[model samples]
Target: MAQLLVTGGAGYIGSHLVLDLLLAGHDVVVVDDLSTGHHLALTRVAELAGRGCRFVHADIADVATVASALDGVDAVFHLAAFKLVTESMVAPERYFRNNVAGTAALLEAMVRAGVTRLVYSSSAAVYGPQPDAPISEDAQLNPESPYGVSKAQGETMLSWMCARRGWAATSLRYFNPVGTHHSGRIGQPQRDAAALAPRVLNALQHADQPLTVYGTDWPTPDGTCLRDYIHIADLNRAHLLALQVLLPGQHGIFNVGSGRPHSVREVLASCRRVTGREVPTTDGPRRDGDMARSTADASRFHAATGFIATGTLDDMLASAWTWAAHNPAGYAT
Candidate 1:
């Protein structure tokens, strides 16, 4: 079994990946600052993994802290970042300093420790709004927000460092990551009140707040924006496949997504069906930098590793509703 170091493993995606790695018989060491993640989430991971896992409460930007956590680690899953497009616009410096500079520090530490294999958690925002359908991995990258710019810069730095320092890295660019673990033990427990499905389900289950639909005048079949949603469980499986593909001298980029597009109205309609409640939604002006459709052509990863996304949109929405029903306040309590 390999020893994996997961940065920000207490968060939504990170925690789910940790559980998957542990179940696959790999030892895990997680480093999280808990800025946006919950401490309770790590507690749940420990319970599920049965004491074979380690949790280090520290910031990824701290060189000494991260270096200490990297000792004897076989591979690193770098999932730590400030990931909010609107917030990044309001605070670009925070995004650059944390996402870009912090990644540089982690890479430097990996080089010093002779740990070369790394799987980076990248995003689809790097492609921005491509005026086409089914965006591929080789598309021209034109990031529109600070968050996207930071991710693009991070990918560039990873490529440059791999070439100059002989480190093997794989940047897995994700589309829209949603849903929860099928076990319903852990999920997206963000302290901030920004998540779409969780918050919408929470309002629908508890308060009768109207779910605001942002912009219904898009050029899609349903007028609302279309996005490719991947289940957290399926995403964890893809990460494991990536780890298996990362050899001593192999490095590349792959997009992890379902390759199928679903509109906002469809998702809301599914949520209403699952919860048996009228999810009231009102139309609003389009947010800046919003795209009409952003789906991925994830054939590269599938061709390389034979990993196909099997979860459907209904599965994603149902699992998200289950998680929301279990944790109503979203880690606030």
Candidate 2:
């Protein structure tokens, strides 16, 4: 089994990927600052791996700390970054320093340690607002938000580094990543309460509260923002497949998504139906950089690795509701 290092492995998507990597019988190591993540997620990873995993609590920008963690690692999965668009707008420097500078530091460390393969956790926001229904990998990148720019910059740097240093890299540009692991032992913890599903589920479990639907005048069937939501399990499996590609082939870029667009109203309605709660609704103005619709074309990854998302929208809502009901206060317990 290969040894893999996951940067931000305690966070939502990273934690799930860590669990999947361990289950696949690979030696795993994680580095997380716990800024927006829970230490309990790392603890749960340890519980599941049972001595097959190692975790270090440190920011990815710390070259010395990250260098030590990268020792003897074959490949790296860089997932550490500030993800919120609004927060990135308010604190662009923090996002740049953490996402861009931190990635640079990690790349330097990887080169120094002779680690030549990497799988980066990129975002669909890099494409910004596209006129097409489903965006392909070849779509023109014009990121609208600072978060998107930071991720786009990270991808550019990885591409340049891979070409210059002969390193194998894959930037998996992910669409909306949702759902929990099927086991339900570890899912998105309480720290990610601001996310869409978590917020809806939290409101549903707590009381019959009014759910705020941001921007109800979009150009869609339901007049709400449409997104391609992929399951966490499927996203993690795609990561493994990407790593395998790096083993014997050249670097590439791939999109991980279900190629289905569901509106915000539809997601909220799904949550309401699953929880059997009276989810009152309210309309609000659209947030900055909000797109009317954003979906991905998964033909590249599908042809390259034969990957497909198996979870449905109902499955995503049910798992999210299950996690929220069990942990009302997120990961505090």
**TM-score of structure candidate 2:** 0.94
Every candidate's lDDT: 0.84, 0.84
Q: Which portions of model 2 miss their true places by more than 4 Å?
A: 50-52, 190-194, 247-250
- Local error of candidate 1 at residue 58 (angstroms): 1.4
lDDT of 2 by residue, 157-225 (tens): 987877788788999999888888655556776455556777676566656665688898988998999
What digit string (tens of lDDT, one per residue) describes model 1 on residues 105-189?
8888787777888999999989998988699989999999899999999899888877776778888999888888776678875
Q: For every model shown, what is its TM-score relative to the native structure?
A: 0.95, 0.94
Provide the lowest-lDDT 10-residue window in model 2.
Answer: 185-194
Worst 10 residues of 1 by lDDT: 190-199
